[model samples]
Target: MILEVAILDVKPDLTEDFESTFKAASKIIASISGYISHDLHRCLETKNRYILLVRWQKLEDHTIGFRQSPEYQEWRSLLHHFYDSFPTVEHYESIILP
Candidate 1:
C-alpha cells in the first residue's frame, strides 16, 4: 500500500470555504480505481494548515488512474485554487513503528 500525502497551507480567510470544497471533491476521488481510503484534517495548532492522506493499493491508482480521468479535471476545477501556495504532495510507505 502507498500513502499519498499533501500538506497544504490555505489562506487563513479561506479555510471554511476550502474545507467545504474539499468535502465535495473527496467523493470524486474516493471512487477511483485502487483508491483504498482517504481522510482530510486540519492542524489544530494552526487552522490554516491542512493535511490530506489517501491510501491506495498502488501508486499508479492515484497518479495515472485518477489524474488522467475526466472526472479529475472537474474535481481540480472545483477545488484547486484555494491554496495560498502550491500543495506539497508526496508518497510514503510504512516504516518501523512500535
Candidate 2:
C-alpha cells in the first residue's frame, strides 16, 4: 500500500472555510479507485496548518487515477483557493521490521 501525505498551509482566517470544503471534497477522493482511507488533521500550534494522509493500494492510484480524472477539477475548485501556497505532496510505503 501507499501512503500519500500533504502539509497544507491555509490562508489566514480561512481555516474554517478550508475545513468545510475539505469535508465536501473528501467524497470525491473517497470514490476513486484503490482509495483505502484518508484523514485531515489540524495543527494545534499553527491553527492554519493541516496534514492530509491518504492510504491507497498503489502510487498510481493517486498520481494517475485521481489526479488525472475529471473529479480532480472538482477537488481543486473546492479547496485550492484556500491554500496560502501550493502544498507539496509525497507518497510512502511501509517498511517491515523483524
Candidate 3:
C-alpha cells in the first residue's frame, strides 16, 4: 500500500469554507480506483493548517489513475482556491521490522 501525504495551508480566513469544500471533494477522490481511504486533520497550533493523508493500493493509482482523471479536475476546482500556496504531496511505503 501507498500512503500519500500533503500539508495544506489554507487562506487565513477560509478554514471553515475549506473544510466544507473538502467534505464535498472527498467523494471525488474516494471514487477513484485503488483508493483505500483518506483522512483530513487540522493543526491545533495553526488553525489554517491541515494535513491530508490518503491510502492507495499503489502509487500509479494516485499519480496516474486519479491525477490524470477528469475527477481530479473537479477536485482541483472545488478545493484548490482555498490553498494559500500549492501543497507538495509525497508518498510513502510502510517499513517492516523484526
- Select the stronger candidate by lDDT from 2 and 3: 3
Model 2: residue 13 alpha-carbon error in angstroms: 0.9
Candidate 3, residues 1-98, lDDT tens digits: the string is 99999999999999999999899999999999999999999999998999999999999999999999999999999999999999989999999845
Give lDDT tens digits, candidate 1, residues 41-95: 8999998999999999999998999989998998889877888888899999878
Best-to-worst TM-score order:
3, 2, 1
Over 4 Å off in model 3, which ranges?
Answer: none
Note the Cα lDDT for every prediction shown: 0.91, 0.95, 0.96
Predicted model with the maximum lDDT: 3
Better of 1 and 2 by lDDT: 2
TM-score of 2: 0.96
TM-score of each model, in listed order: 0.91, 0.96, 0.97
lDDT of 2 by residue, 13-46 (tens): 9998888889999999999999999999999999
| Whole-model alpha-carbon lDDT for candidate 3 | 0.96
Which pairs of residues have clashing backbones in candidate 2? none
Clashes of 3: 0
TM-score head-to-head 1 vs 3, winner: 3
